[model samples]
Target: MKMSQTQAPFARLLDAPVTLGDERGRIRILYEQGNVVLKRSSSVQGVFRGLHRQAAPSLQEKIIRVLSGRIYDFVTDPDDSDGVIWYREITPETDWVHINARYAHGFYALTDVEFEYFCDGRYDEAAEESYNVADTLRDALNLGAIQLSAKDSAGIPMSRPVRRAGDN
Candidate 1:
């Protein structure tokens, strides 16, 4: 069955049929504008029959923005295709204490290797999402804060400047 735009964003699952059932009742799948044949096993049918529509929340962009500020910026080295440079604000405070420095002793080599991995698309479909996420991170860093419309436990919206350790 095709889900309406008003429904939760489940573009991939739109093709799936809508099922309706209860704890102690037989599942009845309501047919929509399709001629699909149900040949799956009862176990598989039971799973979807007991499924409930829910709204999935997405906060990846906000999380990435906040995390980006806590680390250095990385870029592929122009001179060497297999080299990358991960450098943060060169201040007296907060140096050499890199986030992922524990695993890799040399930050330069790690950054370069990671960039090569990115170029090969080892991660998700990063050709586009990577740039968009990078842009969001840059904006968050430049603005000094991740702008979000979330509220606290007391129902108060938070809008404070992000500060690192030992920041004046």
Candidate 2:
């Protein structure tokens, strides 16, 4: 389903059909796209990962799916005047989320979780940029005391300029 146009950083949920199997696990086709890279992440409860994105020339459009457990997923456009942060509660049963390349993406694991995403572009270390979730979305999230990786802990504050490799 599409979100309102008034929302900054366009994103939407995509429906997937699941085929049930007798005495076996189910099969669900999340997405099918050629030349996409797949990434998987496993996070324990109370862990927060990202508000991360790559800059232009290496930007990636992503399709995210929760393989197990639950999370509060978020996406935002750093350039938007309103600084709007769009979020949703996602689970294995939820529709997959498609986020445009311009938005930064992140999630807070509400329970032990395993999730995967398909990216249209390869990862570029020099082009990576991230916002400090604690600094940017602490008040908005209100989920006390989340853990962050060292790289994520050192993320740039949203109030400051986001610098890419080629920026002067």
Candidate 3:
């Protein structure tokens, strides 16, 4: 996973999920300016919530190794609802495989619902599992749904599907 330009330096810092500790893995590259640490806690929060603070541990590393100026395509699902999720792939060596093997495998295989943020506000930012978690990951990050170009990375990965309470 190396970038295209080695000597020119990246246009901007980009972050990628890296295997580290147990619960709090690692996010390398610190994309956002000034944020140095990422934190995580199992609390209910809505997706796309406006100006909400996230709890995931902020991962930081001095710009060193450059991999895939482009985020690899190993985390996408080619099937399911609208194919809307964006997931990161994990394997046995990676910490996430044990965090929840079922979900991790599904995400890697595109058989599970991936997490996604929609509406750009509290209405659908980080909502919990309404559909299959495996399926959700795939839907929320699909190229057509989020429409993120192949050249960039998304702010968040699709860990599960989202929905409102009054749905039929």
lDDT string, candidate 2, 1-168, tens digits: 122343545764544433332221223334433556666667788888888999988888999999999988887798786666667888999877888999998888888887888889777899999888665455655678788877888887664332212211
Error of 1 at 152 (Å): 36
Weakest lDDT window of 10 consecutive positions for candidate 1: 112-121
Those runs of model 1 whose alpha carbons end farther than 4 Å from true positions after fitting are 1-4, 7-64, 67-69, 78-86, 89-168
lDDT against the true structure, each candidate: 0.23, 0.73, 0.25
Query: Every model's Cα RMSD, please?
Result: 21.5, 13.4, 16.5
Off by over 4 Å in 2: 1-35, 159-168
What are the per-residue Cα lDDT tens digits for candidate 1 across 1-168?
455564556543434544443331222233333323221111111111100011112101100011111323232222233433333332223333322211111111111111100011111222111111222233445534221111111221212222233332
lDDT score, candidate 2, position 127: 95
TM-score against native, each model? 0.17, 0.71, 0.18
Ranking by lDDT: 2, 3, 1
Rank the models by TM-score, top first. 2, 3, 1
Could you tell me the TM-score of candidate 1? 0.17
Clashing pairs in 1: 84-112
User: Which model scores highest in TM-score?
Assistant: 2
